[model samples]
Target: MTTTSARRAPSGSVSGRARDFRLYWVAGGVNLLGSQASGLVLPLVALAVSGSPAAAGLVGGLGLTGRLVTAPVAGVLADRLPRKAMMVTALLVAAAAMTVVAGVLAAGAATFGVLAGAAFVQGVAQAGYESAGAGAIRRVLPADDQRALARLEARNHAMQIAGPMIGGSLYQLARWAPFLADVVSYVVAAACVAAIRTDLSPQRAERPSFLADLRTGLRFVWTHPFLRFVTFWAAGVNFVFGALIYHTILVTGRRGDLPVSIGLILAIASVGGLVGALAAPKVLQRVRPVVAIPVASWVTVGLVAALPVARQPWSYGLLFGLVFLLTPMVAIVFQARAITVTPDHLQGRVATVIGTTGEALRVLAPVLAGVLVARYAPGVAALIFALLLAVLAAYATANVRKLRATVPAVEED
Candidate 1:
């Protein structure tokens, strides 16, 4: 059996790499778009269907929980199966789940329970699909191309800028329309993945029970000092980001003066991410990852903490601009670091672990943020998030020296 780390081909062939990236470019891009569309629409749907903000928070938490459950196993599956097949299957399953959502909506019988159940199934499939996608990229591309692929990953962030706005506009036309569109996007992604011809080299592992394999993934992260610190940093920052995201919605909806729509918020956030993604490679090329991580983290914390204090709409706009300016840079650097530290064969499992942790934090943030909103004040959670981020920023900087020493083995395009 072949493994991604063990396989090597001559580098710097444009035609060959282009052919491989086409599958990721098309399928992955569409998936990102569909996901963005669904992400924005789902919360709105939850709000409408359930008529309770707490229930909406539960929907997000439950979805994240499902992703957490699948992440460990998805890594094993990515290593075991053909990557292309796994990605296609995952997309197909997600599409089917969306179709179920559409049917429930069309029947005018949708409930919060139904949405939660559907989101759980869809979230599991999404984790599997992403694991396979990450593993496939590790198999197909050379090292330099992988870095460039990080830019493409940034495109997903860019979509975040546009997708919510688009979904929100579509929602105005009809409540069921966004889900219908999401289903179609998934179908297209499935077809695009099927069109790709590259093979995913499967590694032979001793057949372990699923629980055992999961333990292996967890233990690997625990024993590795760099992985441990990086995961901790990612988890902490993600929790802050998740809290900010929910609060952004709260600010827009709860504030009487500023009637910023969901679309505008998504656009603003995405714009920030796009700026970061575009600048990531350039920044990494200049500054060490260790230096960049703390810088970006502090900038984000500073901006978010100030957001709630901004009494006027213009103040929110100023804070929003600053957020888009710096946070995306942090995200790209962190992601590139994650990709570089792990061996190619473990990319899927590693990504799964990373993603699951982030999602789990997202789940926790909403529940906690909701409590803050319910008890103390509207934007109190954002203030606490800022303080927590400040502590984590210091932690990341302290560990930066250790992480910077682990230079990736360079391969060419």
Candidate 2:
């Protein structure tokens, strides 16, 4: 493996790349805001129409299912096509879908089926856009921009806070408003992506069959112990975290808490992620992954164990926030490492496989948590999740030291 700096364009002439990246950043933030807004609005719309919480969950599940199904195909296209063009096309498709949905809502003609179908389409577009956008980032920026990557992730966290609030408020005012807003955002994001001057198409000598490309990605991850370990660890942690979040929601709702209060608590927890993202690059500069990964894992274990005791809203929020604070830091380090190690031609496939693996269990976690909460106490569910986290922590503690020693040194820009 070669250093990124060795392959990069002259360091002195970074103004063009910097400008292009800034545009890409703005585009990503806009797209994320729209996606998050739609996420909130879709379920609420379903709940309103069907008058059943279960129906709302089904609508959300359909969206995730769409993403899961499309991810592998999206990964292959992202590697073969021009990333900027793919991103623009995806944004346009999403915008068109949302616009039609908005029109349906405005006319009071939307049913659960219609909404679910639209959500699925939007999800597919979102998956493609994200996969291609990641490839675009790799093409436009120098690989060693760790701080820049951290900042991008931090901005994403900030949008997660703002998007829901804006979406919820808009949904309250009028059902069509949130969808309309998302349509506008998609258009703006498309324009931003189109304006980037860098040619973001993959440089390939020959294209392989789609199935062959997908298998290559899977094989690479399977053969690399570090990639395999991190992917599984990420999946396990995400599963537990998803369950914990659902458990919190169940507990709060059962207590007859106000919806606004629950939203506020969750939003407060996201602030911790925002802070962690800002701190990640500096922290990674000082600490090695071997030390940081295990320490963070054990800390998370302690926090999950303590969750059973915190009953009040503020106390619960604080503890939840603290537990999530480590997430962004660890994610930043892991993503930086993954990008550094992966070949340029395989970036799209590798990123997709890793991302898909991490998210595959998340859709099931909420349902499992709800079942557990209904059958047992919330504390019992928390205990089970804590035990799961503890197992993952132990695995990391045993394996990370060897993995860290084997990692190739990839120099920063």
Candidate 3:
């Protein structure tokens, strides 16, 4: 297995890296706030527009579609082109989409078609931005900096905790508000990407065919055992977990529940995730991912098994919160491993391959959850998905029992 050697970063290096990352982090936080607000309302908008659970599924699925279709190409470009330029372009595309949609909403047209179009466009842009995301970090931080990785995940968890509450409040006031926030965020993100003094361009010596480069990435991951397992395992979990989220939202929304109540439920889950993020470096120090991941997976089984008894959305939220608590450690473990294990030139491709594959099943998750929850009792649907996740978890645990992970020590923030 390829690995980045452990090292103590010089104090000057640490300070430089920290200074650079702060700007990027600020931009990402701005982006996350908008995405969270929009994420909360987009499906509700769909459900309101068409009054069909399936339409909600379709609109949500379309966003994933845009991501899946462009991810591989985005990865290649991230490796060949200037990452900052690509990110700026992506931000512009997303901002334009949100701007147009908000304008339509202001004009009082709540059409499903326009919302779907905007979702797809935004998703495409998101994929492009993500393809460059980790590569950008590699430019500033050492690959082996586990604490920095944990901090990155922590920011996401923090945003997750805050986003729904803010989104819910804004949604209560006006639907157009969140989309307008998205436009402003994109501009901020673009400026941040452009302002970074670091050279954030690919440094490859040769240009290969797109297909060849893609195949090389695929081949590398396929040859690795742990990455291979995570690729499929994550997909199944996403499908099941995604079902639960959409099912809860759709069922509750159909019952005339207010957005704030739903946001609180989502925020509760983020609270757990935030705790886990805060503890990730400590957890990773003591526990092997091989143990942590599978244990978390089984714990998830127990949670899902109890889902049948969750009578209210808040009850479901608590159980799901526990599930998310296990996520940040496991999530940081895998991503940090990926960053340290893969070579710099290959980071964009390998990261994207893993990312693109991980999310592919998510497209179907909302649709499947929508259909199942709409057609069957909540308990029965929950049980069915629970059993499905149990199998995937068990399989992943067995395959990875012998594998190991290596992460570097924490750096001063």
Candidate 4:
């Protein structure tokens, strides 16, 4: 396997690389806040205009469709173009789109069609930004500082909690309020990208066709046993976990017997994820990935297995929260290991490929969950998904152990 070592900055009070990473991190946080806000606001806007829950759902689905369609192409561009430039352009475009949407809504001229179109554009821009941003991190951070990377991942998870709350609160003030906030965030994110001094363009001798480049990324993941195992394992877990969450919300709404708010339930889970991310580096310091990931997976299986029987809002939230608490720790170890081994030239494509695999079932899973809940009981749906997760977790644990036994320690390090 070919690995790219991190390039160190010249000696000084603070390295240019370190400064640039800080700037990039700020940019990501700002952009995430905006994106999360828009994610909530856009669907609400659609529902306001059309007065149809299904229509609102369609608007959200269309955004995901845009992301899914453009992800591969965005990945290719991230590898071919300058990473900072790609991020800046994507942010600028997103800012402009959000600005227009905000203006239209403020003017009382917004329509469902217009909102959906803007959402799709924003989604496409987000895909490019995320692809380039991943490459930028690899370029700026020292490969050996896995703890730093884990911290950044944790911060991003924290934003997941903060962003939506900010958005929801602003949305209550006015429909346009959250969108205007997003517009400002995108502009600030663009500025942060512009401020990054370190050059993050791909350094390759010759470029291949887009198809070939895409295939190269796929082949790399497929051939690497650990990456392959993690990819499929993550995909399965993501799918089942997604279904479980959706089923919880759906069943709760249908039953109307919950003592707590669904939003609170989700917030608790998000908070748990943030805590997990924050604690991951410390946990990984004591336990290696070979040991940590499988243990977490099995623990996740036990937590999920109990979800079917827990119908009370607090009980469900506690179980899901515990499940989410383990997620980021496992994720950080896998991601840090993957980034350490992946070459810089392949970073963008490889990151995107893994992201695509992880997200492949996101849209489908909710739909499947709804069907399952409708066909049988919510408990039945939860149990079935839990079983699927357990099976996947077992498979992943075996593969991780086998890979650890076969691979050299230095490769993982």
User: All models: lDDT?
Assistant: 0.72, 0.81, 0.77, 0.79
lDDT of 1 by residue, 47-154 (tens): 899999989877866676777788778888886677788988999998888888888988999999888988888888988888898777754564664356556857
Which of the two, 1 or 3, has more lDDT? 3
Please give the distance, in angstroms, between residue 315's alpha carbon in candidate 1 and its true position after superposition: 2.9
Each candidate structure's TM-score, on Cα atoms with residue i matched to residue i, is 0.84, 0.92, 0.84, 0.92
lDDT tens string, model 3, 256-319?
8887667667878888788778887888789877788888878888888887787776887898
Q: After superposition, how far is residue 101 of candidate 4 from its true place, in Å?
A: 0.5
Which lDDT tens digits does candidate 2 get at residues 1-413? Answer: 22322133222347778888889989999988987887888888899999999999888888888888998999889989988899999999999989988999999998998888888998899899988977666656654477888789888989999998889899889999999999999999999999988888865556667887788778777776777777887888888888888888888898899877677668778988888888877887899878888898889888888887886788888888888788777777677666656656567777888889878988778888889878987777777888899999898788775454243332211
Per-prediction CA RMSD (Å): 4.4, 3.7, 5.3, 3.6
Model 1: pairs clashing at backbone N, Cα or C within 3 Å: 12-413, 272-324
List residue ranges in candidate 3 displaced over 4 A.
Answer: 1-12, 43-60, 107-116, 142-144, 171-175, 250-262, 311-313, 370-380, 401-413
- Model 1 whole-model lDDT (C-alpha atoms): 0.72
Rank all candidate structures by their lDDT, best first, as comma-separated numbers.
2, 4, 3, 1
| Model 2 per-residue lDDT at 138 | 69
Worst 10 residues of 2 by lDDT: 2-11
lDDT of 4: 0.79
Give model 3's TM-score versus the native structure: 0.84
Query: What root-mean-square deviation over C-alphas does model 1 reach?
Result: 4.4
